[model samples]
Target: MKDTDTAEETSPEPKGVNLFGVDPLIIQDHYEIDYRHSYAQDSPFFVGLSKGDLLGSRCTGCQYMYATPRSHCMECGATTTWEKLPLIGRVHTFTVCYYGGESFLKETPFILVLVEFQNVNTLFLSRLKSIAPEEVHIGLPIRPRFTKAPTFRVTDVWFEPMGST
Candidate 1:
C-alpha cells in the first residue's frame, strides 16, 4: 500500500523531447514552447564563424581535412591542426524543410545545404540563402554571409550563391 501510494504521488518521467519546464504528459498533441540553451565557444568552429572565416582541421595520420574543425580526426584518431579555408564551396546536396516537426515547424520553408569546400575533405551543413527552392541545385557555388555583429553562434552566418554558379 505504501509503494502504491508513493507511485501515485510521483509523476511519471517525462518522455520524448521536453522543452523548458513543460510537462509532457499534460501537453496536447501540438503545442508551442520557447526555450534557450547555451553552446560552448571554445572550439575554432564558433570562433571562426564569429570572424567570418572558414576554419578547418587537418589530420596528419590520414591527411583528411575536416571543415567542421574538430579537436581530433575521425579517421585513425589523431590530433588535428587548424587552418583557414577559402570559405567558398559548392552545394553537394540539400533538403527543403517544409516542416521542422515537434516544437520546431517553421512557418516558412527553409533549405539546409551540405556544402563541399575547396581543398577540404569534409562536408558542412548550413542554411542556404538567396536561392529559390526551384533554383537550388547541386554544384551551385556558395559563400558565407557573415553578420555585422556575431554572437559566436552558428546562426551568425549563412551561405549565398557565389554568382550564377
Candidate 2:
C-alpha cells in the first residue's frame, strides 16, 4: 500500500553484516570455494614431490638450469628437460614473514628461503622449518623433507636443518 511497505516486500534478505568505522567500512561474511586446477605441463614437478624427489628444468640448448619447473628455457627459448634436483642445498637468502595470503595466514611468522644447490644456476624458493627466524642465516645447510601423505602440492615438500631429525 505505502512506499516503505512496497520497498520491504521487494528487498532481498541480508546475508552479511556491515561494520562502519574510522577510515573505511568493513563487511563481514563467510565465503568458501571449491577450486579445481590442473598442473598440465607441470605435472611432473608435483609428482616428484610425492616421490620425495625434487624436479627442475634444464635448458637443452644453453645447459642453463632452473630450480623450478619450466617447459621452455628463459635464456635460449629452447625446450627444457626434467632434471632431478639435489635434496640438499644451502640457504642462499631468507626472510621472516609476519603476514601471508589466506592459505598461509595460519602459518604466519614462518621463514622463506632461497635455496642454492650445487651446479644449479638458479635458486629455489621454499619454506624453511624447524628453525627460528633469528636462527636462519646465509649459507645454512638444509635438506628437503616430503610429506608421507602427499597432496601433489608444492607444500608437500619443505626444507629443514640438515641435522634435524
Question: How far is each candidate from the true structure, as Cα RMSD in Å?
Answer: 8.2, 7.8
Worst 10 residues of 2 by lDDT: 15-24
Native-to-model Cα distance after best TM-score fit, residue 154 in candidate 1, in Å: 1.4
Q: Summarize candidate 2's per-residue lDDT along 60-126 as a digit string, tens digits.
A: 9999999999999999999999999988999999999999989899999999999999989999999
Cα lDDT tens digits, model 1, 1-165, are: 565577645766556756476655764586669867654433677777788887778897888998786777898899888787776788999998888755336535888999898788889888897789889999998998888898876767789998844
Off by over 4 Å in 1: 1-42, 101-107
* Model 2 stretches with alpha carbons more than 4 Å out: 1-25
Write out the backbone clash pairs for model 1. none
Instruction: Give TM per candidate.
Output: 0.70, 0.82
